[model samples]
Target: MRLAIYEIREGDEPHRLAHRLLGDFRRWTELVELNRLDPPYIANDPAPYRARGLRVLGPGDRLLYPYAGAVEPVGEEDAEAETYGRDLLLQRGELALMGGTVAMVRGLENLRGALERRLRTRLGELPAHPDTYGHLLHQYVGRAGGEAELRYILLEAERVIRQDPRVAGVRLEGELLDGEHVRVLAYVEPIPPGSPFPVEVVL
Candidate 1:
């Protein structure tokens, strides 16, 4: 298995929030120790890792950090198909969120066409923008609430991804403190044979 560790350093306020939510000031400290990170891998300092491009985390940034367990592709065909499907979903989701109706519809149509061409499978119909809007609204509601709610939402998202057959496992790497606040770094792993993703709760 190939492992890639992505770290996000919490800003001062976020760090405090984490402590409050987890009800343990040393929760993060414990995790850092458990991970056996070296002296330079300090949780309080985002500098060293930022210089190495591992610090992509930001305030309100929900990241999806992927860890590929198998260095070798399960098989060229499966790997290609999985990659294509995931990329298409990401692209479509982003376009749907940012583009206005006219643009979104156009983008969706384009995505459908592209997916069909690449996978020989129709992506089926696209949901109305209002429906998408409502979904997003619900998500926003969940994310905007207290730390407990935020943790629930994060866990739920992880569950959803892990349930997908294409994903082998998922890991949640972030700080969840006691005060109902969080700093997240999440990732997904795909198994050789289709299986739901597994999650490793980092901290």
Candidate 2:
């Protein structure tokens, strides 16, 4: 890993530093984690800094850049932002699949089955909790009753994921596969506060 130094300039926030040093602000999360720096970002746009605390790189602050060939990590803020964007895209694209362009591709029988397989794998891997009376065990998961049991065991997981402000809504369901395995589906959406039809006047 090569080490380099960058002098913080006026209003040079961590994300900005990532863009300047790594050519992509999205890697800011990595940068801050690497240097153990606090993020100094505030935003009206659901900033990435929420996941990490960082301070803006004001003038006179020397920041460290660590790198391995062809890999540039963000300054520890952009990843959180990108993660939100990505989560939104995943949810939007997934929901749109019920009807939309992506549906055609996602419609393939093999692909749908593939999604089922992947979902099962992901949920099955959640670490078990000792206090849960041996709950969330990877081995016992993906079985017949496991789906219902998981809803309770993973209630906190659901709550935490739903905590994302952008996450407008979420629905969970499970299906018995081949009379054996259980495939779970989580549908998420965002519904802005409003009435379908409203009238407003302005001067």
Candidate 3:
């Protein structure tokens, strides 16, 4: 597929770009894939979004628009649709948190990182100035209140985690330390062939 550069405009979103460029809103995933967006958060005003470790093809940024018919449409059974990778998260080597050496990650190691990533990022934290989602654990972390209060907070977190397409299950474990801080332990099952076993993460 031959590719062309499409400059992002204010208030622009991937679905809009895909429809205008190819007449198929479902092809929004294609635009994101070709662009290799890290954290894959699209936005207009990207400053706050970027601060949350999200990737946005913001205003004035140029992205790839393959010639019509270059990218094949997605199918339900397609692994790309079923899992994160090309559809959700960047390939292991494409983006790194620390620095170099992440390019060679394999199997569950990659999935572990991916799960942790979604947890660390806040929802609205990664979008345009007018964010409606993304409030991470750190934002809510504080002195644990009554048992009912803690349960409610964790339930809210579980609800958010369930929203991620790749996450099939979420189990949270936490303990109040000295009544001042809560240590959150998160366990997640990412869409597989990364791993069928649950992965653990401390947030």
| Best-matching candidate per TM-score | 3
Write one digit per residue (lDDT tens) for candidate 2, span 59-165: 43345565345556754334323222221123422533444443322112222232232333333243431111111224334445655655542442233233222
Tens digit per residue, CA lDDT, model 1, 1-203: 22222223355332353364345555655433323333333334333343343322222222222343436555654444433232323343344343534232322232233322222111122332111111111242324456556666465445333322233456664454544344444455453323332233222
Candidate number that wins on lDDT, 1 or 2 = 2
Q: State TM-scores per candidate.
A: 0.29, 0.26, 0.44
Candidates' C-alpha lDDT:
0.35, 0.39, 0.55
The segments of candidate 1 whose C-alpha lies over 4 angstroms from its true place after superposition are: 1-79, 82-145, 174-184, 193-203
- Across residues 1-203, which tens digit of lDDT does each residue of candidate 3 receive? 44445657778888888899978999988877666555444666664655555555566555666655545654543433223433233553255434544333434454455555555566655554224334455645564465654565566456545544345577876655545455556677654433444444344
Write down the TM-score for model 1. Answer: 0.29
**Candidate 1 global CA lDDT score:** 0.35
Worst 10 residues of 2 by lDDT: 194-203
lDDT of 3 at 10: 78
- Which candidate do you rate higher for lDDT, 1 or 3? 3
A best-first ranking of the candidates according to their TM-score comes to 3, 1, 2
For candidate 3, the lDDT comes to 0.55
TM-score (C-alpha) between model 2 and the true structure = 0.26
Cα lDDT for residue 57, model 2? 33
In candidate 3, how many Å is residue 111 off? Answer: 3.1
What C-alpha root-mean-square deviation, in Å, does candidate 2 show against the real structure?
A: 16.7
